[model samples]
Target: MSHNAASEPDHHPVSTAENWWVFRGPADLPPPPSWRGIAGPAGTPVAQEYLLSPEDVAVVNTALHLRRPLLVTGRPGTGKSSLAHAVAKDLGLGEVLRWPVNSRSTLEDALCRYDAVGRLREVSLERERRSPRGASGRLRYRSRGRHSDIGDFLRLGPLGTALAARDRPRVLLIDELDKADIDLPNDLLVVLEEAQFEIPELARLPEDQQNVEVLVTGSRERVPVSRGTVTCDNFPVVVMTSNGERDFPPAFLRRCVRLDLQDPGEEKLRDIVRLHLGDDALAEAEDLVQDFLQRAATQTLATDQLLAAVHLRITGADLSRDQLINTVMRRLDEAFPA
Candidate 1:
């Protein structure tokens, strides 16, 4: 599962090129300048150069061809979330639309959000301006604006905007789906299948005025929606990750192409350490990697743990190597040991 073998560069099929083109950004709108800085705080494009096993590459390609959401199940810190970022960067899909899942998450939260309180305040202020009595005397009430444009109160959430984007398919990351409510995954079935969602506030508008422009993720500008409904020309490359916290409904699973990420082997771990730390740290990193392998035998040992410990050592942390291992190389399950 080397990078070259996994990427399958030699097999230049027409479908592969077409799939690659689907992720290219629109010609009219250049990607925001902020992306250069935001994508990689440390000079790397977020997820662009991330290593993928052969199985992962095959599964991703399949998902791209079928236009289905890719559901990734793996241990925590196995780069599940990073995979979304990597795909977006490699494909030139601008910024990733990330919707983090939690116990209270709902399908509505991922679609669009309405600011009722802000709308009400606008109404109240408009009413006050139109009142008969003023400090001086009664005068003709002049309307500045129509209460407030409904678009002002509506903002598309990550998923909604991704679907609405008229350009290339956006990369949407539904992080940690296992942490969400049981009903959340099941609720996503229609949205995932139909590739669209409706906003009630916009739908209620007159037919003549239903094309409202609203803010969404990615661009600083807003996009127009017809009749308050958002439909995608190209379905988003959705990546939903799970840490094995719970089971998803079978119906939901059937719609998605699933992949399980394998834990990195010692050589892969060495490569990762070399990527983050420098070549100078390899000799020391090898020793620490061995210590981490031992901890992994009994419990979860994320790649980040090894990176952190090595970083501290290389930076001349005042502690001994043994002390650093003891403090930073502990098992991930130590806090909640059974």
Candidate 2:
């Protein structure tokens, strides 16, 4: 379905069938909404509830319906990264494939990593080995495996692995997209549009020899490839996050469904506190929550600060410790200095 910025969510899961999509690894499915655990971070054993506002739910559902990457922008620690984890958990999509962006991150780095030195070393060792001589000057040698196979030296990165996963539509978190260089967003346009990528090493081989079986980042088994091309049978649910650090190119923005997360209110804060801690801790942190709300009015604060403070209090740490609470409550805007 075609989607515009104003598109509404359908409010349905990606697929209805429980096992509609399967993966090789252990699945991290959250408890039903009626149960205790609706959402939190992924891979947690206990079920904890994470309440999503209707607007939040709409944006997520809209992204799913549109099949476009969700570009999430917000202040630091506003659950931007956690959104991807929540989607994966709720949808039974298995572990999230995360590519944390930095100032030096490149598009190729996220697609695949080739160990050329390792491959060269293996080739050198193979050439140096001599066959043992049998009786009557006959040489006995074991057959070498496909020593020239480029797949041996190639491992798909998280983004590429998510694209290559055939069983299910994996959740790919391109966290902190603004941390990347200016060219990064434009560079992603092609891959995002094509839903496939070519490996130069594999692509350079003769057409007949281009087919190889390769291992991906998150899978135990190898997948078949042709001409070193990795195509997506099920396009991954991509969630790209930014801290409102930089302006993206118009073309890049045009391709994504954007959402700007707002600061959490007292009720949501209480829910988040309860999710991490328990009912008793939630009650104890009420005063702290009010203080947080008052401070958040003029300064930037992350949800994690509240969580940290509550955790410390529950663990019997002295809240009166000098600079302890201050350290936890430090604002990102202050640290980065605009």
Candidate 3:
């Protein structure tokens, strides 16, 4: 049954001003300048170098020197998460092993995941492939209970992969730890100090099968795990970001080096602008940057908001200041000043 074109409903009549959308059907835009879209030839994030304050640099270095996790706390868009990317990129560490935390996230989930059901299914299939049941003595004799390879059913997560990397330290970004369960921070203390984790699935294997090769999160290649234990030769650079939403346990906080990313100053803001938007956009950006700075003082505003407005303005969007305010430069709290 063929349907007429008019039979289908329109999606809000294609908007009153189609050109208002930067994501229209014909005018697809690339990713934002501040974003890293994909992996490069070197198998790392496509991020450019980012600036950090002198104090932040010192604190990061202290964490590296002490072989402790760097706990970065700050407001939104203050570069807490960006610090991990910058460190990983500048240090020639391969792709960062990022563990995005949430209220339901578990330590086991970040370490590794085992597909028990998949392994069981594989074993059942193997059993089915045996000679037909009750046909002959051979049929019944061939059906001994045997399991599939456990390695095929297990994959190491980001945290596990970082601890397993032996050549050099990989950067482990534990983003938004404040959103994690209250117990999570304390749970991480032992792992951060030990730099190793044991996989009980592999541990319970036969004495002869002490070692297994398993897949890791970001790579297809399997890494050899001896005695079911993955230990790092060098401590990984662990960076945990918090948005000042919660306080961690004293024990957890004691093991970490703390760094607070303050709001970028005028000089730092200009550098960030130049780095992301480039020199071509800089000439027309000063006034807008000034406007953003002034507004930031009065209300909660992020640096990205300024970048967005500047991006639209320089693109010849013909938007008025009032329009920009109502749309792009709205306060992070979603309200205008009194």
Candidate 4:
């Protein structure tokens, strides 16, 4: 029943009956045929066969083993978010819990929400329907479920799921920490330190059943959660991404292990293209990628722009380098404005 790198087939048909909610047996979720080619120490890949480096592998492995948050800073299209998926896949961790941060995001957004207002409205309507008749045939006020507490509808959020999952370590992707407000990161300090967060609605439940555990992610918005700062005690594996838009506060930098991602070399890009496409397509696309990379080096384009060109070359009607270069340059202008 165990999956090994060599024995598994490259492609297997998933059952039509199988769905995300319906649990698949172990036999159903076999390893990919080329698993061995991608695996490195600690179950992650040494390189993504193209983009990663020895330093990148080392940093990722250390974070995975030590269970510390690994902060990754890079320009856009440097593959920050993809690293989370690669780690999860390597470790046999199921799916990643992605918490995309933006302005106006709050701790409550990360934690569970108590539908206090909704519950009150529901109770009010129920009470009005059941009230006894008063003078002039008007109904007198009598409460039905008004006494009911709002805590019943409180549900756990991403952070709650991570803390509670003791069986297997979950991969939490906090993408674009810079986009969030200042208070968001500060609010996360408590949960990261304790490895447990509280849902006020849980007070309605017995003390034992009220708390939810989960992993958390923050964007660079620098939300202030509390006056006093907190640090992780459990050493939960945290992955934070930055697009290098702004400089972070000194105090915040002190809390994390930071790594900067460099652009993938030509050989690595070739490997990646081959892995995703085939050898024939890779040969045709390599020169175009090199040109794209040259532009990227000059700060004239982004990695995504390069990827788009490769994708178009592989799938487009004409696989010529000229066609690809023209397509990519056009996309670059649309994606990145002057």
Instruction: Return model 4's CA RMSD, one decimal.
Output: 10.7
Residues 1-338 of candidate 2: C-alpha lDDT, one tens digit per residue? 11111222111132323332245433334223212233444444332234567777798889899999999998887778878877887788977889999998989989988999988997766654444654556776855665556687788888888888898899999999998999988888679799999988888889788788877885556788788899989999999999998999899999999989888888778776765565677787677788788889898888888777766555544345334458787765676546
- Candidate 4 accuracy as TM-score: 0.67
TM-score for each of the candidates: 0.82, 0.79, 0.84, 0.67
RMSD of each: 11.4, 10.9, 10.3, 10.7
Off by over 4 Å in 3: 1-36, 39-44, 132-148, 335-338
TM-score of 2: 0.79
Query: Per-residue lDDT tens digits of candidate 4, residues 1-338?
Result: 11111221232233332231224332334333232345534354432323467777887877777666777887776778877777776676666667788887777776655567887887776656676874458867675444443333444456555554555667777888888787566567656766755444444455454333212332111211111122222334578898876677766766667778877667666665556545666676677777876766665455555655655554432335676677655433345546
Clashes counted in candidate 1 amount to: 1
Better of 2 and 4 by TM-score: 2
- Off-target runs (Cα >4 Å) in candidate 4 are 1-51, 125-152, 204-236, 316-323, 329-338
Residue-pair clash count for candidate 2: 0
Which portions of model 2 show Cα errors greater than 4 Å? 1-48, 130-148, 321-324, 335-338
Cα lDDT of model 1 by residue, 1-338, tens digit: 13531321111121222132233522222232111224444344523247776778999989989988999999977889888887887788877889999998889978999998998898887777888765577674766665567787788899998898787889999999999887888788788888788899888888789788888764457888998779889788999999988888889889999999988888788776665554666676677889887778778878877877876665445556798787887777777647
Local distance difference test, per candidate?
0.76, 0.75, 0.78, 0.58
lDDT of 1: 0.76
Provide the lDDT at 245 for model 4: 69
lDDT of 3: 0.78
